[model samples]
Target: MTGLLALAAFEQPMKRFAVLLGIGSTVCVVQGWTLAAMLFSLPFCVIWAYCGWLRTEPQLKWLNLMFAALYIYGLARHIWWTN
Candidate 1:
């Protein structure tokens, strides 16, 4: 019962996260950060591709880490570019 409820609670957030990442990836691509965009987009792509497999895949976890690191790097580049 509790476990079911926990699963239910997690489901929506994961769905929303997947959608958000998808949109973010699209934005990156549109902005012409091709390589950075691909790096930024990979986790969401994996999320879309694998769906329920995220829980079991260490590579997906590492992909998310790479996404985060790339996102931070992109932010720094943007700030540097604007200045």
Candidate 2:
């Protein structure tokens, strides 16, 4: 995710906006704001993945794939953590 963000920061014009949305969504989660974080985080995640898929570098492609796996793992962990 960080790798994707870094790449987006370099290449994408909307990177900053996406990052801001992520931060806001994180804050919402921390503040116990209902399901809004999940919704907000969705776009950031999608954009990250999209940007990663669009990357031309082989190393970045691998990194993106790893990041995506880790992201899914984190989501699964969160479900268990909350339960």
Candidate 3:
């Protein structure tokens, strides 16, 4: 994901927005604000992926699903089933 973001920096005009999402997610994860990140990233990535954004190769196509699952799991674990 970091790699993709780095690549986005080089070739994407939308990199600034992507960077916002990425950094926001990273900060939420580090701060254990899982639900906040999940709320932001799930919809963001889905839309970002569907719009042919990111400009990634075919091999990385499944990244959207992976990111969705990540947020789902994080929300479930951190917010729904908290310790």
Clashing pairs in model 3, backbone N/Cα/C closer than 3 A: none
Best by lDDT: 3
RMSD of each: 6.0, 7.2, 7.7
lDDT tens readout by residue for model 2, 1-83: 56555655455555676698789888988999745676566566655656656665556556645655655666677788899
**Candidate closer to the true structure by lDDT (higher is better), 1 or 2:** 2
Error of 2 at 36 (Å): 1.0
Which pairs in model 1 have colliding backbones? none
Tell me the tens digit of each residue's lDDT in model 3 across 1-83.
56556644444445456668778877888998868878778766654564344555443446776777887787778765666
- What's the lDDT for all of these models? 0.62, 0.65, 0.66
lDDT for residue 37 in candidate 2, whole number 0-100: 70
- Candidate 2 residue pairs that clash: none
How do the predictions measure up, each by TM-score? 0.49, 0.52, 0.53
Candidate 2 deviant stretches above 4 angstroms: 1-11, 56-83
Q: Residue 34 of candidate 2: its Cα lDDT?
A: 40
